[model samples]
Target: MLHHWYISHHHLYIPPSMTIHHHHHLLLLLILFLLTPPLSTSQNDTVSCPLNFDLLRRLVGSNRPSIDSSTVCRYAQQALRLVESDHLRRTSSFVPPPNTAESCWTAYQAVSDYFYPNFDLRRNCGFQTNWITVPGCMNITNRQQFENKISNSSLNAVVSACNQSLTGSSCSSCTVALSNLQASYLNGESVGNLTDCRAYPFIYAAAFINQLGPTDRGTAVCLFSLSINFSKSNNKHKTVIIVIVITVVIVIVLFGSAIGFWYSKRLKKLNRKRRKKAEINTVSALDSYTGSTTLIRYTIEDIKEATRNFSRDNIIGRGGYGNVYRGVLPDDTEVALKRFKNCSAAGDGSFAHEVEVIASVRHVNLVALRGYCTATTPFEGYQRIIVTDLVKNGSLHDHLFGSESLRANLSWPVRRKIALGMARGLAYLHYGVQPGIIHRDIKASNILIDENFEAKVADFGLAKFAPEGATHVSTRVAGTMGYVAPEYALYGQLTERSDVYSFGVVLLELLSGKKALLSLGDGQPVLLADWAWSMVRNNTPLEVIDGGMAECGPPEIMEKYVLVAVLSSHPQLYARPTMDQVLKMLDMDFPVPTIPERPMPLVAGIEDIERSVSSTGSAQLSTPRGYQAYTFEMDVRLASKEEEEGKC
Candidate 1:
């Protein structure tokens, strides 16, 4: 009886009612085929594959059992190495001969008979459609590429139309079965006039590999399959040996990878623990400086969200310390969020200083300390954040010496008002507060101004409080270069006078319309104070006055300003007027006493308040107020009245 058999993949499907005779014949053909390898360990010899049926029989020999002629032809067609790489190479090269169809058919049969039974073949090979057209097949260059497209493409949906149809094991089994079928065909196995089914798949796989360039990572998988060839009687043994070797190698790789992964994970966990411990230690130290106040921790997420995710568009300014971003609070109040460098050497201390000083202090002239946030939220990489009231109109430095348009617009009256406001702010910092806070850094930049030209002392990050009876504070020298006091800058001796000196520098900057550090040619560094002093000494001080001041204020008013600047910027610490003295000078409420003409007191107060002023004549207080004038006559009169009252 003649029967039709078609091999789709590795499966060898036979139709029902093929007859018991065919079944017996098929089983016998499988059992007695001389293509089977010997059990002995000695045979490692290579044998050529049969190009025809006569050659196939000659290879099987007389000791082999009877095998079907068609099966023989199929085996021969499927026995060649269609996909292979050099022994050392892991990647596969898919270069096909002119007759790709013949080779692919042989590959199909090889894989089919080798891995799967007839039933599996019947189910998968139900359709003999043009599975891999050149265009469709060549598109998949690598295994990963193929798997990716297949997952999203109709191939995956149609291949197993049902939901949850395949597990990992089942999928691997299917791949193996299909691979065997393809191998069988590529081996030159033929069925009737259909040529070999397996050879076509190999050609298809090869065509794809060719397009993906040699450097493609996926080509290794295709080459992996070609390393094993089953042709001689002992080929089965060789195949088994190779499979065992591959399995052992795979197991070793998997084991090593597992160990490596475990170590990496363990190291990561240890690092996390160490980092957590370090953070806890740091928080503990920071808390020591804070009293009765709970530090508000802000998660990185909270900060990002609060600052609109630290958007670059929201950035207001950048300083030596860190960038300042604009943030809107939950209540819709805008604030300037100063972010400190995470890895900065002084970030922790600076944060502590700002929080400690700003939290407890409240003053109108001082920038109101709103609130701050630390590592309070679950966001990543956000640790230190400080929120302060947003000062609009930018910094005082901007208005004093900003763009030409800005400077021209700042009237002399406004400039004087800003200077007065700044003085009051410093006065509050120096003595107005209960604990007497000293602003370590007092510069134009630190003085923020509002639209109304109201000066607010800002950036108290370096501020310190003077303890009772402490004349000077010993600290690490920290301040802007030019504004830093010579005493503190040279010898780390911080005192209220240091701020006086810095304020003096700012006053000079204000009057001169130039930075405190300026150059006037001749290699002479024209420090604002020295230049202004020289101008005053030469009586040409009006030339140094800001032109804006020149236009708005009276010439005489500018001369008084020159006097104020000279008094404010006295080189000697004792000579410099106190913040209170400066305020009085600005307001002109106190009289300008005549100097001694030779050597006079650097600081002259209201000692000669009631005395008349005369040029070149020294003023004296003959009987100052609150001094007792003892008179015996007035005492005797009071005693007589007392005696009379007692007698009555």
Candidate 2:
């Protein structure tokens, strides 16, 4: 049997499957292969590729006025090095960046100067480009796409066969696998390119190595670097042993260095955390001074100094989750700083939500956020604070029920203005805003009063945004007991109407100068909502007006305010008027809807409202377009005054 032989680059290659006896005859084969002139074949047939040095040397020698082959080969070698340094590079997988076809054009032209003027090298361009663009069939940019085209087992086999450290049968297997892999892509179904190009084993290895990472590139380059004599692979004992020993030493040093690096990083991280704690513990106190008035995220140190280190004397208002301090900022601007009591994650979540809501809204009737601070320290744990412009007259609750000294003789006209201002604030939250906000904690305390007694709604920590087209958002109840709507307080069913109900309770307090929960001789507290409704139902609405007002209003106006409050705080969910309706009724642009008959059990908890709602099955509530009363029909005895003023 006869076997064909070929000289591939400097290394002579034979099919791994072919067995040759008496290797001494191989010398004759090499002589015959090099002595033969270069030849070409069709793309499908086996094509003989030239050696890198020999290809350039032969081109120069083939010229009529033959230039030095050695000088031309040197230029080609330099050109090959520049190709790797400049043209071939890693790129983003999503976008395949432009690769100038000129890169291949330039490398060849760099060595083409030695050719005879009449004999240009353009015809051998494709063959010459293949010299540097080995394994050119693969697309490195779309790695996942390229890898998906080949089977996993075949790819793994190819990788192992082409390992740089391997030789002999390994090299033969690699060559065969590479040909099959290369041929597989030539059927017009490849990733980067579909057509076949002639390439020797060394050039083929260079193209493949371009796609590999550093270590693999080096190892694989070694595979092509070796001029392996298949018959004599076993004879390179000293070389193989040296390669194995070097690989082992390099790996050991790498592993030891990696372990040391990991420990170093961990130690630095621990030290950083420890240093942070120390810094917080020893943070120096800051001195107060006038500075720029521009609002910014004030640091925790700035807050402490401004509030006199949170002295009790500085505290102006106290609430459920935080305390408000009357502070003079560095700019000499007066601000009410609220420092939260709870520092847990849930508190931070609420703090973030409050900031989000406060930041989104901007209205004259709403408290403006001057600045806020969030700090984490070992001493205070987590500090969440917000600063707002200090209301000159304090909160509505302070004027209405606070000590007499805080009260500035509020006349009925001023009271009415305050009432209208509060209505406008709640109205904006309900109607003007998209996905309206529900001021869940709409009570006297959250209603701040300015020097002109203009109401500014404050404390949005308990507020919730009413989603568009949503009837209600069921959530855990989060409002003050007296101000909380019956449905939300009991069932956790929240809606914009819940805020309307809370607003009604606040309205009654403003109109009557009474607390939301009016305490009688009995231990049970009565809802001011029921008491006002009972008085109005008895045709004695004037009795609900606050007598302490500087001046009394017209009977009709007083009666109208009383009627609006009763309807707004109506126990039945559908009976209560919305803030928009309340505003219209307050301004007397529209008549107050008839007082909805609240059921007898006024002393019951929020659960009583649920029962009242079920009783009015499928009853849709609607407001009159103008000065006409829309009446709600109900059959029930009104709760006694004693019962109305009992437990909420």
Which is the leading candidate under lDDT?
A: 2
Residue range with the least summed lDDT across 10 consecutive positions in model 1? 595-604
- Which number leads on TM-score? 2
The C-alpha stretches of model 2 lying farther than 4 A from their native spots are 1-295, 405-408, 601-648
Residues forming the 10-long window of minimal summed lDDT in candidate 2: 622-631
Candidate 1: give its CA RMSD in angstroms. 39.8
Clashing pairs in 2: 525-646, 525-647, 526-645, 526-646
Report every candidate's CA lDDT.
Answer: 0.53, 0.59
